[model samples]
Target: MTWNCRGVGSKKFERGLRFLIQERNPDVIGLLETRVNFARAGEIFQKLGFKTWVAVPGMGFSGGIWVAWRDEVGCFVEKENAQYVHLRFSGQGQKDWLATIAYVCPRDKEKQHFWDDMAQFAQITQEPWVLLGDLNDIMAENEKKGGAPCNSRRCELFAERVSNCNLLDLGASGNRFTWKGPLIPGYERVYERLDRGLCNPSWRCLFQNAVVKNLTRLSCSDHNPLLLCSNDSGYGFGPRPFRFEAMWLMHSEFDAMLKGCWKGEGGLKNRLMNLQPNLLQWNKEVFQHIQNRKRKLLARIDGIQRKISNFNRPSWALINLEADLQKELEEVLHQEEVLWYQKSRGQWVNDGDRNTKFYHIRTVSRRRRNKIVMLRDVNGDWVEDQVALRQMAKDFYVDLYSEFHEETVQEKSLFDNCTVSFPSLQTEELCSMNREITKEEIKDAIFSIGAFKAPGEDGFPAVFFQRKWHIVGEDVVKYVFHLWQDLEDLKEINNTLLVLIPKVDRPDSLKQMRPLDYVM
Candidate 1:
């Protein structure tokens, strides 16, 4: 829970906070603009049940922030200043995470340093992190009402900083505006969405059920409190979709694995159909343990460093072991970046800059944004149950495609009734258009495609063929020529999987989505 209390010294404000604590009892809570020094803040917090707490004294009754938590919450301040405080919670059975509560200065010049600090935090930490409190700015014009039209430049800057840091906005569920201005005689009072909750992809992945709700504003303050709730009952969307990772090409045994799968199949398509499960198994054994491998390497390196520091002179063998561990860690980090970059689908950015965390966050944001959480049915009623939604999707597509299939069976004499004369291609022109494809042309076409583009339903991207040309080129050539020899059966070679993607942020009806097909 986070609230810009404005001034906690008032009897009404103090009573309100006490009532809120009794009702909600949040794990961690932050109070902003307390208008109290450390000594006075301590006296008030003594009555609260929380055992651990940190406070930034107000600068002569202007601004202050306080963070407090119960013993089991295991919260401690990692970094702090007058503007913000970064807290770390010890995760007993899961990975640890950071929470930063900020009360940004209203002036842009004074807040630039906060943005710089946030960027540094993004680059350095792999932990799931969340930020909450009054930021003193809006993200878009729509987020402000009754204001001298929102400064687009300032809004853009705030939005860019949030995006660069890979922080996904944990959109509030209640009030559209968090803060309201005091009454002005001639001019209308202003309201803006300055206070909110935001978190990195790691955090979203960690707490998939996290939600933010804006509480009702109290009579004592202009800003409303925000409640953040998160749980760990995460479930998968459906059967795991197999995606061929680019890092698989980096493995020395990838060729051998492909050879094993290729030898027992009927054709290129059959072989590819059989290869998906094998690749999945291979990935589980080889690449899925990257994070664990990194941890072990780090532990070993730290042990060696400590050993060397304790000794007057370390042995050559010990030094060599440390060097080897360091190199292995570097390779692991690189492969990790490759993994996240592929998942992120952000090929526009060049690699080799150690952007693993950034990519990780990007992937999370994309998933959250794309997921169909709720939908409106034919009756215009909302449907949110997973099973019902899935059934609806299946029925809708089945009916649509079935009708389309029926319409496509039009007579071959569709143009026979036309009376107007039209230009026709010569026999030689027809031959040129339907000419046999050459092996050289096929090779050039495969090589020309981007290596890491989206994979087909066969779970293999162009990069797989581009890299394994030496082993699979002949089979690929034969498959292409076989389709040319029997043009009627070409649909067997044109394998595609149609997937529905939302065309808008909040797609209620199925019509708001479009079908995207993956080529094989």
Candidate 2:
């Protein structure tokens, strides 16, 4: 979400941001310009129940980047000397993910510094990360509608920077232009896809199903918001056909059935148990045959779709398309229903036709196809209601798990090789400080304490508290207080007591050590 707010203060921009958040309710948003100081922006975001990560370079008349995330997603902003926010999405038992939002000045020689800084950050983390923002450079001649004739040098530099980081641009969907100049009646308005999102190869794969939505401007800012929606891709179409075996139908009874059928005779039991392989193989073949026919039908439909897309005049094409689709749908309805009924004995239901077997096949096939189509549609669209969305979401996760299982198995090697180490310090040093408790232990204790709450049991767990501690600088023991802190709204989790511990490494250190227990 790149916007040239001209010179809007934190207050006005915040009201608008709140309105947008309420409207879209996106998990994350990237904002630009935001002439306000970093601290002021943080307050505005906090007021909206959002954790803000801002990158404001000192005293320069340049734009800045800020990302405001929902309170639930634990995000921390790493404030670097350079003008960019490094945000890490953290959670239990999950590999952490990082995303950086930047605002590059279009007319700065220091622009090179931004890329240099980002490249260094990438080299440092080497984790799955996304770097997205208004790069202030258009890649192609076609990308700029009326902006100053495209600068090949700047574009090349941006490309080189991205290549150096091994980052990729998620292909733009819908209109190519991201920002359009207010048009004068005769001449066409200049437009350019300056706002962009780039990610490492690993993160690219993670967001394989994610989409970059080019939204129409509400005339609030010069640049339109680019909404990125990462959805589950499991229930979607791919190169291979997904399968659910009929044997799974008897999965609940498998143990009992096997025990009863092959309990006594050793050799015979072995032979019977071995039959599982043949049974599964036969079921797979049956499933594949059905899948193949469905694929063929889908291919035929897609062929028509391609023709329709290529047709210069869509209105004329729709005439033939509607008739053809109707015929194809009717044929599909019949074959899916009638043939399925003949094969299965009252096991299936066809929702379209009253016959059980036929109804099951046709309705399921149609529903499945429709679901796939919906998945392929643009992001943030309400293609279906809650039930359909939930099912699709579930399917996507299942597919993701299946596809990534091998990758995850391979990731063990990476994890093993990863320099996952804690900063060296003894337990005695921790015990010496009144804050002997590790930060991880504190977090865990907070989480555990909240676990007893019904909301936590129901999955929306959170804890809110105010912390006061003594800040010691040798002879000076200055006491400062931090208040009304919601664990859900924690960003960065930096600034520790006594300046000794890093907050990120302690995941379960506080599980048994309560903050009150320390006083006790």
Candidate 3:
């Protein structure tokens, strides 16, 4: 839990802290703006049942940060500054992870140093990481209300730092604003969401179902505490649909597999349909080998560690073997990173950052955001059951497209009376618009589109054609030529998948969704 405890030395703040610790029983607690000396902070930590604690002294009683955790959780301080405390933690059977508790200075000039420190830390750390606390900043304009408007430049810089660090906002529930100013009238009641939880991609992978909730503000403090909870069993357990990964193109055997599958097809579409089954089989047999190798490497590393621990002095040969295994493990991990990075579809993040954690979080966040947890039906009733929700969406969309009403004569006449005109095109302009598509133009058009986009109904993206152009180019060009020349109904090629995106935060009704057409 992260909280800005205005001043821990005060009786009211102390009482609030005690109540919070007793009520939540969190494994770790990070407090900012404590405004107390180290000795007093130590006494409070001891009384609060924290066996290990660290505190950074405040600047003349205006700012102080403290991080405390129970003895059961193994925690070691890795780094600390006036603005943040970084710690490495490990527990029984759990992977070691990093946590940084930060409290940014309210002053604008000091914020840059805080961001610089964080960026440096992110660059050096390679473990699962979570950074939480009051950033003293807002990411969006709407995050603040009743102020002289949040500094747009400041918010942009803050957002850029988050992106550069490869962090994803774990999105909070409960109150929209985490910090409130004095309740003065005349546009003085400032409110902002200054506190949030941000984590790296690895942390999201480890705690895939984690949620950050901004609890109600305590009476003694203006800031609300954020509670991070992990619900491991909340994710869907259904079998995942097969997706052709862009990373697979990097493999030596991918081209061979495609060539083998393409040899036995009829039309372009039929060939693709038949090739899918073979590709699925290849994924299971060949692509899955990478994961299998990872598991074997992990087993070998564990076995070697056990042997080294048992020996009084490990032999040189054992050390060499461990180093080799570690190197191979790192390479396998990089491959896995590439696989997830391609799957994430996060184009904003740079490729060299090795932001597998960011990619993992993006995928998880998208899944969670898109999930229909509950829906309001036509009868104005909320439906929670998965089958019921599915039926509701299905019925809503089906009726939307299937039901058609004939236009009345009066309504038809409204359009008939309306006249629209445009300037006439010159002969040269007309000729240019009517010109036939060249082979080079078709190739350029296909290449110009994003190669890693989501596939349409045919289950193929532009990348497939671009990568296997040598084998499939002739059929594709011929099909395009015929379609352009004949100008006939191409219903199969024209088929599209309709995807619904929410137009507002927390859309409960079908009318709130906007449809996007994904043409095959």
The total number of steric clashes, by the backbone 3 Å criterion, in model 2 comes to: 15
Q: Name the top TM-score candidate.
A: 1
lDDT of 1 by residue, 87-120 (tens): 9888668778999999988866668988888989
TM-score of each: 0.65, 0.45, 0.60
lDDT of 3 by residue, 1-520 (tens): 8899888878898898888888778888988998867777678989888878999986676778898988887899998888889989887677999988989898866778888887887898879899899999898988888857578998898899899888878876556789998765556689999999899888878877777767768988999998776543443535565566666676668888888788764667778788778887887788776779799999998998899899998778878999999987787677777677667776754644677756776778876565655566778665656677667878777776775845668869989998988899999998997788888887888888788788877677788789888988887877788788874448768877678887865576778798888753
* Span of 10 residues, lowest total lDDT, candidate 1: 403-412
Per-residue lDDT of candidate 2, residues 175-259 (tens digit): 4577767676666777878888778756754444555656556545777667666554544544432222222222334334334
Query: What's model 2's overall lDDT?
Result: 0.54
- How far is 369's C-alpha from truth in model 3 (Å)? 7.4
Each model's total of backbone clashes: 0, 15, 2
Maximum-lDDT candidate: 1
Candidate ordering by lDDT (highest first): 1, 3, 2
Cand. 1 Cα-lDDT: 0.81
